[model samples]
Target: MIVATVQGNEKGGKHITVKDGVKIFGKEQQEYINNIYDKFHINRIEIIGDFGIKKIKSKEWFCYMKHPEVDASGRTGIAFIVWDKNTEDDTIEKTIREIGFRDEDYIKFNKEYNKIKKGKSNKKKQLIFLVGLGMGLAAGLIVITLSMIKK
Candidate 1:
């Protein structure tokens, strides 16, 4: 029997390229990474959900990280954080400590989260959606009217 690969694990062969190492792409975030890889020759990419970041490690090159968002409450909040790791920089654990992802620590995730939900953001989107929907409905009605007239 064949075994199913587990996600986010080394044994899991779920990746775009897996020749020497690994590369995973999500959304339009690949270009920036490609440039870095071409220059640095990155080795692996691992997503630390607990830390809310994609950690890219390279033995020959510099390591870099990209965080999607910090989980603040019942849902995942939005705060795109990018860390350009350097030898002189503090350790990842220490850098994470500067962040407030955990409840016990500073968890500065809330600051960006609060800034996000200022207005009724979905209102404009919903209005545009409804307008498109109404236009579609009117088009259908006109088509039906024309068919009836033709008959």
Candidate 2:
């Protein structure tokens, strides 16, 4: 079992240790995380990417968890130590993408992936694309307006 640590920070900025040794029984690591959060009682959790030797400061390679209900004082913060048996980095990345997380949506993906994974829902993914489209349209209009003014 490959073990990963999930740390949680409380409202007071204190660190709270939740549960460790959280195991992923099957192939789908992300899906497993989602199910754990959904079925179990957790305040908040997130998957953080680790930038090993490459030192990549992005969410493309690591997983983590956080809980808001547990705190540093042992009151409202929880940490879930997850286990993954698969060691293939490519497979993990592929799974993330298939779940609707774009290469750029790593962080946001971590935040919302659980919702879809647990409930088997896709509402959040649709909203993300819709928001992206709206932003693109606004930018296009601004560019066109500026060009007309210059003319």
Candidate 3:
């Protein structure tokens, strides 16, 4: 199996890289990845497949890590996608650290992503409500002005 490490982004962006001739959700691969995530308490696992030249597809059975710290931060997390190989007898967390990712950093990344998503949702709702309110007030003012002119 190939071993690779991904770096976390500051803006809570999800980064995905596709490799050819690799299956991510075979029985053994899923079990192995699940075990590692369980041991280290990862926040989310997204499996994507390349759809010929820049398109990709999300696979079923994606695992979401329920880390409250990550859930609150709105920061992005780091994920390493291994293909065509199995993990050897080594601690997965240690390997991740060696790739310049601290355990705490991963948690923080997850938190940031969650926070950003929440903030975006909230902003959309607020903007729509404000726009509607503004339109209503404007219409009401126009009606009152017309009545005063008639009087």
Which of the numbered candidates is closest to the native, going by highest lDDT? Answer: 3
* lDDT of residue 20 for candidate 3: 29
**Taking the tens digit of each residue's C-alpha lDDT, what string does model 1 give over 50-151?**
323233343222222232232333233222233333422223334333332244322343333223323334666788999999999999999999999999
Worst 10 residues of 2 by lDDT: 51-60
lDDT of each: 0.36, 0.41, 0.42
| CA deviation > 4 Å runs, candidate 1 | 1-119
Clashes of each: 2, 12, 17
- The all-Cα superposition gives candidate 1 an RMSD in Å to the true structure of 16.7
Better of 1 and 2 by TM-score: 1
Instruction: List residue ranges in candidate 3 displaced over 4 A.
Output: 1-103
Error of 2 at 120 (Å): 6.1
Candidate 2 per-residue lDDT over residues 1-151, each given as its tens digit: 2233233343545222212222333345455456445523342333343221110122222343332344456753233333243334444444434333346644553445444344433666788889999999999999999999999
lDDT of 3 by residue, 1-151 (tens): 3333232343453322222223333465446555445533343334443100111122211122222223235643445433221333233334434445557744553465446547867999999999999999999999999999999
- Which scores higher on lDDT, 2 or 3? 3
Q: Which sequence of candidate numbers ranks them by lDDT, best first?
A: 3, 2, 1
TM-score of 3: 0.36
